[model samples]
Structures are given as structure tokens and as C-alpha cells.
Target: MKPPPGGLTAYEAAGARYERQPYNRSGRSGLKLPAVSLGLWHNFGDDRPVATSRAILRKAFDLGVTHFDLANNYGVPYGSAEANFGTIFQQDFLRYRDELIVSTKAGYDMWPGPYGEWGSRKYVLASLEQSLKRMRLDYVDIFYSHRPDPDTPLEETMGALDHAVRSGKALYAGVSNYSPEQTAQAARIMRELGTPLLIHQPSYSMVNRHIEGGLLDTLEQEGMGCIVYSPLQQGLLTDRYLKGVPDDSRAATSRFLSEEQVNRELAGGLNKIAEQRGQSLAQMALSWALRDPRVTSVLIGASSTAQLEANVAMVDGPPFTDDELAAIDELTGPASSANR
Candidate 1:
């Protein structure tokens, strides 16, 4: 809770933040996000020291990771991620706010009561107001309806996103966790409202290829950019689980990834392929996620500056060849035991 030794000073970002990374255009829009963005879904909560979270944020920005994604229920205690991020931004990164693409979402369970969650206009707008207040910002670069609300009319949910942009509270509108058909509907609605959907954040990893089922095609046809989350599959695709789960791994501690999911026998084959390509399993997984042209960026999280550096290094790895792609397909194909 206390400030770092010297008491914070006016921090200057790294000159190399934009040097090595490549930026991808977001769905024909003027916005170009780094191929790899930083997500605050983990470790930026109340459980960790505020100084640790601040270091991660500063490192990410110093690496040219302009886009930072957040949601209403990101932290262990819900809202704390934004609160923590706001503090860091104010202390060190506020001056470069315009150079960053800070985003937050609503439409998830953040509190009690009927209006506490979902895609109702009341809930979406109110939740964003709370998020903005927590982040201490006037507007988010992109605001999303965190997930689909089956009971709510698509128009209403999409309208809330459109409203967020049109009203000067959000620079862009988006939706997350919606199906291919649902995404098409939301995009159509936003286009009709004159806002035009900006991006779609989905869970797409080597093992979890559900986005390949139809979502990627939908985004491509609609000219909407796709930024996927869980590119590491909660550590399932990383070296940490390839040699058996470490005592400190997420699988060992977080409910999101269970220890049983760590199947070294299944992952060993992919790890071998990664080694053949002279890349780490984590680096290979990130490269595989960006192979599709529709994907604008891959969202990654880090527990420390070292992990962040390793993930960002994927941008410099060699491209997958035809044989490598075939090998990967075989490894992640429906018949593969590792496919999840």
C-alpha cells in the first residue's frame, strides 16, 4: 500500500515501446492496436501488492501495449482491478493517457439486485459510469457489453454500447462472448445506429478453437476486428504445464484452471513442435493465434515483468510453415486428446 522507495516521480515511457512490436489496424478503423495487448484479468487485484500491479502496467506500456482490457467483474472482489488500475494510471501513466487505448466493460454480475448486471440499458450505462469512476477517466477507448443477455433484446444491449460511444463516454462500441449469429446481429444494430461495432473479444486459444467454428469468419465478413483472450488457455498451453504443473502455477491455485487439466502427455507433442521451430510453447501459441488475418490482437496477462517480456517476444518469432501448421492442426484437431 505504501509508495515505492523514492516516492513516485514523473515517469518516462521506454523509447523502445513501439520499436519492435507491430500494430494491426482495428477493423478498417483508424485505431491500430499492438499485436499483443495486456489484459488485467489476473494479478491486478487486491490480493497482490499495489506496487506489483503498477510495475506490470508500466512494463506493458513501455513495450508498446496500448490496449488494456478490463471488465466489471475482473478482480477477485469484483471492481478492484479498475480501482487498482486507476491508482496506477494517476500515479505514473496519466500524462500518456491519450497515447493509450484503455477499455472496460459491463453486462456481468458485479453486485446484487436485478439492475446489478446484464444488458439492460440501465445496467450497461450505470455499470460503465461506475467503471469510469473507478478508473478515474472521462471515457474508455472501447466499451463492451461483457456478454450476451439471452433475455434482453439484442437491440437494447447493442443500443447501450452505441449510446456509450455517441454520448462521449466511450470512443468505440463492442460486444464480448456473443455467438457468431449474435455478433452479426449486434454489428448490424450498431451500424444502423451509426456507431459501427469496433471489436469482438473472445476466448480463442490453440486448444479452445471454438472461434474457428464460425466466429472468425463472421468477424471477417463483417469487417470487425477480433482480439482474443485466454490465448494461453489459462496456462494449459504454456511450458509451465507441459512438464507437469508447478506448485505455483495457476492450475494449482486458481479455480479457472484445474490441476487435472494439465495433461503433459497431450501437450508434449505440441511442445516438441514448438522446440523444432526454435520457440517456446508460449511463444508458439501466441504466434498461432495471430495466423488468421481477422484477428487484430491477442490479449495476454502477466504476473511479473519477466513473463510479460517473454509473451511480447512472440512478435519476433519465426512464422509457422505449411508443415508446422499441419502438425499444429493435428495436435489441436478434434481427434487430438488435448483439444478442449
Candidate 2:
């Protein structure tokens, strides 16, 4: 609102730093997004300092990271993520809204009671209305059903998605945490409703490889793009754990990525592979996920601007060599939640 402090457009120096990165196509869609997108899943709640969050958001856009991801349940307290984004949107990014692709989802637990979470049309619609109010926007570029709700009817969920696009509330629809089979079904239904399913947001990294098991194939065939979250495997794939958890890492602050999850054995294996590649494990993890052409973008989270700068630079890092791939295979091996 106040000219975005230093202006939303990057200064000459910032533009120079961003000159080398290229945008990638999101499936067969006309959309061209940066290879790296930011996820506001954490540190965007009421508890975290807002100034730091706003700075990160401003820096992200200035450097060409246009797509920002969020969900109803992302905050330390529910609905805070959207509210936080809303604040930044009004404060700094309002004028540059056309240069942004803002997406928020509503399939996870956001409030108490039976109607609060899941894929029900009633719940989805209500959640979206609240999100719109919080985000201070008439529409979101992409809206996702956070996950499949087995108890709810698929038609009802798909119907809500269709209505969102048709009613001019959401430009595109996506499904997160859905199996390959489920994604196909939704795509089929959306086609009939005249709103093509646009993307699939899945948890994928070198450590989390569930999408490799036919999910990638389905998306390719359906003309839906894929954006993988936790591209650093909850920070395990990063060098942060190589020397054991630091007090500042996610392992210390959140239960989502526990220290026990990054046990010594796992960290050792990752460190060896990272060293061989001459890259930080975090950079290597991002490069690994981006290696797949089906992955239109990797959804990354950073607590600070410096961390984001290091994370996105993975785009400029080396591509995997045969020996590096072989070593990674021997270490991380096949994708299994139990193994690493």
C-alpha cells in the first residue's frame, strides 16, 4: 500500500541476480511458472512474526517466484495462513496481483466439528468463502481439495470444484494427496463440468517418491501439471541434519519433521551423497525433484529470505550424473516411508 517499501519490482541488482532462471510450463496448460514456487504452510500463522513473513513474500515475488501455496489448516492456529497472506497482499502485493498466482486449499481440518474438514461441498464452499474474505480477493488463481475424503461423495466434491470455477471464484482446480486412480476420476468429472483439472499437489522429494508409482504417468496423460511439496523431504534431505539437528531447524520447532525422523543413519547417507555431488543435500533434493519433467514446480518453504535464496539456487546447481544417480539409489533406494 505504501509503495511496497522498496517497490515490488526488483531493483537493478535484484533483477541481475534473477536473470538466469527460466520459467517452466505447467503441463500442457498455457501457464508458465517458475521452476520454484513458495509454500506458506508454516511460519504464516498468528504466532510467527508478521514482518519476517511479509519480507519473504515480497522477496519471493521480486525474484520471479510468482506462485504461492497455502491451505486452511496451515497456520499454527487455523485460518491464519490465509489471513497472513491477505495482510501482505493488501500491504505490498495488491498492485502486483496480476503478476502472482495465489492458491489456497480447503480439504484439511480447519475448525472443530464434523463439517469443519474434508471434501463435502458445504464445508468446501464455506471454507472458501472465509478464505476469500481473509485473502481480500474476489478469486484465487487455483483452489485445491486438500485430499480425498472417502466418507464424502466424489461427485459432491468435484461438483464444488466445478462450481468454484464456474461461479468465477477460482480459475483452476487441483487435488492434493489423491492417488493416481482418484486423480484420473476427478479429471474425468471436471471435463464433463467444463472445468479442466489443472494440477496435482503431492508430497514429493528425493526422500518421498510416492508419485513415481504411476501418479506421474496419469498426470502426463490427463494434461494436469504436478507441484510436489516438501521437495526437501521435511528437511531430512537437507544438510541441516548432517551434523545433527540445530536448535533453529524444523526438527526443533515442529513435530511435523521430528529429530527421530532424521536419525543418524539417514543423515549420514544423505550427507555422503550430497558431498559427492558437490552440493548441499537441500540443493540436491530440489534438483532431484525438478529432474522429473512432470514436476512443473517444486513447492518450497523457508523461514527466512536467506534460506529461500539458497534453496532456489538449486535450479542453477548441477544436473545429476549417472554415478550420482546410482549412489542416490543405493542410499535412499526405492521410495518407502519406512526406509528413510
Candidates' C-alpha lDDT: 0.88, 0.84
Per-residue lDDT of 92 in model 1: 81
Runs off by more than 4 Å, candidate 1: 1-10, 334-340
Model 1 deviation from native, Cα RMSD in Å: 2.2
Instruction: Residues 1-340, candidate 1: write the lDDT tens digits.
Output: 3344324545679987889889999887888999999999999989888777888888899888998999988887899999989888887877898999999998889999999998999999999999999999999999999899989999998888888898899999888999999999999988898999989998988888888888888988888999999988898888887667788889898888898777787579999998998888999999999998889999999999999999999999998899999988887783232434
Candidate 2 segments exceeding 4 Å error: 1-18
Cα deviation of 85 in candidate 1 (Å)? Answer: 0.3
TM-score (all chains, Cα) for each model: 0.95, 0.93
lDDT of 2 by residue, 148-185 (tens): 99999888999999999999999999999999999999
Clashes within 3 Å, all models in order: 0, 1
Top model by lDDT, which number?
1
**Candidate 2 pairs with clashing backbones:** 1-91
RMSD of each: 2.2, 2.6
